[model samples]
Target: MSARQPHELLLAARPVEILGVALSPVEYSGVRVMTLTMIDQVHKRPDGTARRNFNEHRARLVMGEDFFELNQPNEIRALGFSRPQGGTPAAVLLLTEAGYSMLVKSFTDDLAWDVQRLLVKSYFAKPAPATDPLASLPPEQRALIALMVDNASIKAEQAAQSQALAAQAEVQAEQGAAITAVGQRVGDLADTMLMLARPAGAESIVHIRERINKLHGLPSRIIDEVLRQSPIAPKPAGMVKHSREEARGGSYAVYWIKDVSAVFARFSGECTRITATQVTHPYIDGRFKLLPARDRP
Candidate 1:
């Protein structure tokens, strides 16, 4: 008698669990056999008034393979087949040894059971087939499916809008910080220029005014006022003095002015001073007066 085929023997055995569900594959002689099993379990609560319930269903599909290999046992198990070594071989080989090992590793280690369950549930319970043979679906179920689709679309739009808004807010905040920083720098520069322009004793007001104009971009009139508020010294003797008469036309006459009054005179006889003829009218309305030659003691 000829040896029994592996597929024939496999069909005779009961179904086994691979990942979580029990599965089996059967070959028929003439007619196609399709089997579906639904298993329901309930556990009573401590109060006996409530029960936790679960329903699991599986569908068996018949597929053909040419050969089988032994390296990966779990892959065959998941597909409702025994390990290659545990069964007799047919004339045709289905999968190579290396392929079987890779499949088994992917099934046992790489695939997540929770994600698989969610996918299965979504496929079987959520979507409706175009040609479902079932007689009728309840109104509530149709409404629920519609609501779920609408809610998913709304959530996606909301998430996108929220991300865009967050990005805009971040950009605005950065711009605001940069503007504040620039304002602070300008204030600091102005303060530094003011400090440098402050006049001390024996410093020429004109020289201080010129420095202030260069450093702070201030008008010459503002520089002069700043210098006038500060201390100054008398012009030294023997310094060449230019008269305003020589200051006519486009030329300016630079001269030294001597102070012979008050504290500056008590300490020193004379200090160097600078006077420049005005080419443009001073911004402040004031007359530039040359000090009367010091009265002879």
Candidate 2:
């Protein structure tokens, strides 16, 4: 590597004499900037003065536009600035020209005015020409530029992976819902098929009640009421002569299974009306109860 000329060395050290304090050269995103330490030193303010001011107006400041922070020691050191006395700092803040203006807005002293004018002109205003930018910047500043580009690429890749995972989860949720709906529909079809496949013959009242129970799984009270109140003298076309031990003189009339559906329909309508009115069942405890005045049915 060729040695820097005498005039180049003078240019490098000029900011210290111009600002009345030792200010490091820091640049980022192809723009010259000042660190918090550099700003405090150049402005003759107390250590951490710039940091305090930054914290106070942090909400209004836009990151990447007003300032940048380097958390890693390697990245911070890449700026070639002096490390804090104790050890490497956890973060180093880089302030742009606009950021510096905002940070020292409250300082109106003559010294503040003079320092700001000189630094803006002699230090921050100087930029390397576009034709050969890296040729002018030191090796450390070039390394920092490469590091920032790599970090931005990594962040973009991570964002794409997160979006893909979210889309996959949404598709899985939709598939699960569709499967559940199909299962419910299949169960309903099975129940309907079982109800329609009854045997073709006249059935005794007891047998009819059992068949209804198997088909509907209805509450016991509903079936009991329908069997007790249906006409005892069955329809001529639907009745069958039967002899049963439990009947008086061993004789009883049974109903055709096909005709029993009408009785079920009529009695079910009455049960629904009673349920809607919130009235007590007619045959509770084997005794009929009059409808209450509050019941509309």
Candidate 3:
């Protein structure tokens, strides 16, 4: 047969077991590196039963050197194997009887050549197109296109910035309103506390209850803050309802506090104790009833 081409030779050697596959860059030039492991096995029948045993073989292969050059230590050395200085240079390693048999049985020249060709094809393919078809316009046209894109980008960025600012402003306004509302409610709660702390003879539970009832109409934050500063325990679990006569002489407003004590206790145990201005009535004889606070008229 005629001598194989360079590519064909590379392909044939592709599957050859290299002793030390240089996983990293090496000091030598024009030398491709690879590391591989070898396994040996024996099959036998033990007492009429089939069995197999395995052994491991390891070696490094240094290619591309003449038979006499391979023995040189400086030429190819990776792992434990190295070429002796100024010895018979050979491209192929001299394997022992077992090693030779194993390699011969495990790999074929055709498979090695085929794999090498595939590796060459994969690594040395044609370059890809750098730009899309639409991007390859005349110089003036491209400049105009780029300018348009820049302007659109600027406009989108400006709109987004404006929207973020507006949202931030709106949030700030809501926060300011909530703060003011909470301050007013806190003032009202202070008044109620003062009334409750009055002398026993002058104490008016009705008035205190009325003041607390007004808190129901306040914003949730104010209500929470008032409760935070009051001495009353948190509302108990389950549903709670309070019916109160309006301070302005209107119909009674019915309010519900779900898990009132639990919610109150979340912010309890501070210098300022929060008490509920209302009470819940239990179901009596399978019927629900509304009972006013003892302080209520």
Candidate 4:
């Protein structure tokens, strides 16, 4: 079949689950095509691994027939990706079944083989959704069907209302749990304040972050970046003991808190009003679920 445009596919695609991953479906022409991001996740490869494979083997692959490149923001956004928070992606590479087969030729693992089989048999070759049986009926027949649907909906609504009332106690319990979480967050703030009152001596990034978090209200990640990258920020005094299981070799570098404190206060203060915003991209994870045609921008 001739490939339809990306926008056309957006109307017909529906979400599907494979190996516990919820894939945001995208079809081109009549065949399902997956982005490099999706391919990386579905195959358990690191992020950008698929893209790296494609780039390394581009000389052997055919364009338009085997793969399609979407560089325009609107084109990519139509596939259910939100705009990048920082900047635009260079290009989003979408691969056909043929392309995927060619790209992963080196992935000889059992999991790779199983996933390829499933993608071919279940994902790419899956049948389209059946059309509504009543869609082609006469006006009079359609009216009769609509009336029946309305009556059934009324009964369902009544049943739903009863269920809602029964679920109210569970809702109250959830609210109480939320309140307890708020109290725990308050305790964390108190700990941060206590750390702040201590002498302005050397401390680990982990410890210094708490004070910065309490004073500047910036995320730990952002604070870490600012301190690490800023020229004015001081270097680590020496390595400190780390007891956390996540730490490698059970040790990490510790910086002087006095140096980092000034850097955090300066940068965090510059951004006085920080609006909470989220920019999501399509992944096997449902962080960016496939939006319906009506919901797509």
Question: How high is each candidate's TM-score?
Answer: 0.24, 0.37, 0.33, 0.39
Number of the top candidate by TM-score? 4
- Identify the candidate with maximal lDDT: 4
Preferred candidate (TM-score higher): 2 or 4: 4
> Candidate 3 on 23-125: residue-level lDDT in tens?
1221112223221212111111132111011113332322343101234343333213433464333332322223323333433456444434432343222
Ranking by lDDT: 4, 2, 1, 3
Residue pairs that clash (backbone atoms under 3 angstroms), model 4 = 3-29, 4-29
lDDT minimum window of 10 residues, candidate 2: 4-13
Q: Write the per-residue lDDT of candidate 4 for residues 156-196, one digit (tens) a residue.
A: 99999989987997899999999999999997865444332
Local distance difference test, each candidate: 0.37, 0.63, 0.36, 0.69
Q: Using lDDT as the measure, name the better of candidate 2 and candidate 3.
A: 2
- Residue 235 deviation, candidate 4, in Å? 99
Candidate 2 global lDDT: 0.63
Q: Who is ahead in lDDT, 1 or 3?
A: 1
lDDT of 2 by residue, 41-85 (tens): 777889988889999998877787788766777654544545546
- Residue 294 in model 3: lDDT: 43
Candidate 1, residues 145-200: lDDT per residue as tens digits? 77999999999999999999999999999999999999999978654433222223
Q: Which stretches of candidate 2 lie over 4 Å from their true place?
A: 1-16, 78-83, 127-297
